[model samples]
Target: MQDLAIWYEGTALAGALRGSGHLYMVVNAAHILGIGLLLGAIIPLDLRLVGIIRSGPIGIVGPFLSRTAGVGLCIALLTGGSLLSVSASEYLRNDAFRWKMALLGLGMLTIAAQHGGGRWRRAVETGVPDPRTRFLAALSLMVWLSVLLSGRWIGFL
Candidate 1:
C-alpha cells in the first residue's frame, strides 16, 4: 500500500496539481461545492424520511434529491482522489483518513441497502415510510455526518 501511495504521489497529475498556480485551490473549492451539494440535498431528504420535516410528499422530491446527491458524490470522489494523490503516502498513514474511509464505505453501503430494500421502494411508491426506512435514514444522516467530521479531523490528526 505504501509503495502504491508513493507511486501515486509521484504521478504527473499530482505534479501538475502541485506546480500549477491556483489549480489546487480550484480543486479544493470544487470539492467543497460537491460536499455542499451532497449535504444540501441529502439532509433534507433524510429529514423527510425520518419525519423531521413534514411538509412534502416523499415521492415528489426523493428521486431528484437522490440523483443530485449521486452527482455530488461522484464529483467529490474524483476531486478527493486527486487531492489525495498530491500526498498519498502521508494521508495513508493518517488515522483520521482511515476512519473517514471506513465511515464513507459504511455510508455508501447504507445508501445501497436502503435504496434496494423493499421498504424504501414501497415507501416511495406509497408515499409513506416504515420504521426500518426511517431508521436507515437516520443512520445515513449520522454516518455521513461522521464522514464529514472525520475528513475534517484528518488534517488536524
Candidate 2:
C-alpha cells in the first residue's frame, strides 16, 4: 500500500494537478460543490424519514427522494475521484481520507442491503409506512454526513 501511495504521489497527473495554476483550484472547487449537492439532496430526505415530515406519503416520497440523492451521490463520487487523483499519495496517507473512504463503502453497503431487503419492496407494494425504512434512511444520512466531515478533515490531518 505504501509503495502504491509513493507511486501515486510521484505520478505526472498528480504533479500537474498540484502545479501553480487555476485548474487545480477549479477541480477542487468543483469537488466541494459536488459534495454540497450530494449532502443537500440526501439530508432533507433523511429528515423526512426520521419522522421530521409527517404530511407526505412515505411510500411516494421515500423512493423518489432517495433516487435524487443517489444522483447527487454519483456526482460527488465522480468529482471527488477527480480531486483525489490530484493528490492520491497525500490522500492515501491521510488517515481521515482512509476512514472517509471506508465509511463511504459502508454507507453504500448499507443502502444496498436496505434496498435488497423485503421492507422496501413491501412498503412500495402496500403503500404503508415502515419504521425500518425510516431507520435505514436515518443511518444513511448519518453515514454520508460523516463521510463529508471526514473528507473535509483529510487535508488538515
Candidate 3:
C-alpha cells in the first residue's frame, strides 16, 4: 500500500496539482459543489421515500433525483480522486480517511441496492413504500451523513 501511495504521489497529475495552489483550490471547490449536488438531490428523494413528504409523486421525482445524484457522484469521484492523489501517503495513514472510504463504499452499495430492483418502481406505481424501502432510505441517510462527517474529520485528524 505504501508503495502504491508512493507511485500515486509521484504521478504527473498529482505533482502538478500539489505544485499549483490555484488548481488545487479549483478541484477542492469542485468537490464541494459535487457534495452539494449529491445532498441536494438525495436528501429530498430520501425524505419522500421515508414518507416525510407526500405532496409529490415518487415515480416522477425518484428517477430525476437519482439521475442528478448519479452525476454528482461522478463529479465527486473525479475531483476526490485527484485530491487524494495529491496526498495519497498521508491520507492513506489517516483513520478518518479510512472511515470516510468505508462509509462511502457502504453508501454506494445502499444506493445500488435501493435502485437495483423493481422495488422502487413498485413503490412509485402504488404510491406506497414498503418497509424495506423505508429502511434503505434511513440507512442511506445515515451512511451518507457518516461519510460526510468522517470526511470532515479527516482535516482535523
Badly placed stretches (over 4 Å) of model 1 are none
Q: TM-scores of the models, in the given order?
A: 0.96, 0.81, 0.96
- After aligning candidate 1 to the native by TM-score, how far in Å is the CA of 122 from where it should be? 1.6
Q: Write the per-residue lDDT of candidate 2 for residues 11-114, one digit (tens) a residue.
A: 77677777846877877777777677667767876676677766667677767877876777787787677667666767887899999999999889877966
* Residue 141 of model 1, lDDT score: 96
Which is better, 2 or 3, measured by TM-score? 3
lDDT of each: 0.91, 0.77, 0.91
Q: Candidate 3 on 57-152: residue-level lDDT in tens?
A: 888898898899888888998999999999899999999999999999999999989978989789878878899999999899888888889999
Which ten-residue region of model 2 has the weakest summed lDDT? Answer: 120-129
Query: Superposing every Cα of model 1 onto the true structure, what RMSD results?
Result: 1.0
Global local distance difference test of model 2:
0.77
Candidate 1 lDDT over 1-157, as tens digits, reads 9999999989999999989859999999999988888888889999999999998889888888888988889889999999998999999999999999999899899899888958877888888999888999999999989989999999898
C-alpha root-mean-square deviation, each candidate: 1.0, 2.4, 1.0
